[model samples]
Target: MKAENLAKILKNYTSGWVSISKNYKKVIASGRTLRVLLQKLEKMGNPDGYLMRAAKDYSGYVGV
Candidate 1:
């Protein structure tokens, strides 16, 4: 997916799991935990797409 599009879709999410469309053009679902997210997906007939995490604020996050 393009960085520009990804940033826009993820802007509202500070922390949680997000289900994005396969073409990366839309948000299918989101949840504070994986389990909740999966349950939501199941209810949606488990649409084909990608599962991702919207992490905590990274403005001050340090990673290796």
Candidate 2:
């Protein structure tokens, strides 16, 4: 998926760790931390995904 499009989807998330589906077509789960997110995924049978964080303020935000 395009970065621009992904950004649009992520904008809907105010805070938390977001798990993007393997196909990048949808959000698998979201939680306040990796452990929480992983637990949620475990309940869902642990589908593959990528992790990303959502901020309260995106402006001027920098991630390594």
Candidate 3:
């Protein structure tokens, strides 16, 4: 996935609450708030893809 595409997904959310697939093609996780979004990511392992959004909103995914 391209950084540009990830940016596009993030724009939709002003807050840091979204997770995209490794290819940045699909949204694997998303939340209206940062906390919820993070919980989702935590449940998931470090996916091949990457995450985008404000640093304050996301700190990266944690593994189970």
Tell me each candidate's TM-score. 0.77, 0.71, 0.47
lDDT of 3 by residue, 1-64 (tens): 2223344555556665567775556777777676777777788874555554533332353322
1 or 3, greater by lDDT = 1
Put down candidate 2 lDDT per residue, 1-64, tens digits, no spaces.
2333466557678787988876667888999988899899999999898888877676665433
Off by over 4 Å in 1: 1-4, 56-64
Candidate 3 lDDT score at position 51: 54
- lDDT-wise, the better of 2 and 3 is 2
What clash pairs does model 3 have? 22-49
**Model 1 Cα lDDT, one tens digit per residue, 1-64:** 2333466676788888989897777889999998999999999999998887786554543322
For model 3, the local distance difference test gives 0.58
Best by lDDT: 1
Q: Rank the candidates by lDDT, best first.
A: 1, 2, 3
The total number of steric clashes, by the backbone 3 Å criterion, in model 2 comes to 0
- Top-scoring candidate (TM-score): 1
**Which scores greater on TM-score, model 1 or model 3?**
1
TM-score, structure 2 vs. true: 0.71
> Which ranges in model 2 have alpha carbons more than 4 Å from their true place?
1-4, 56-64
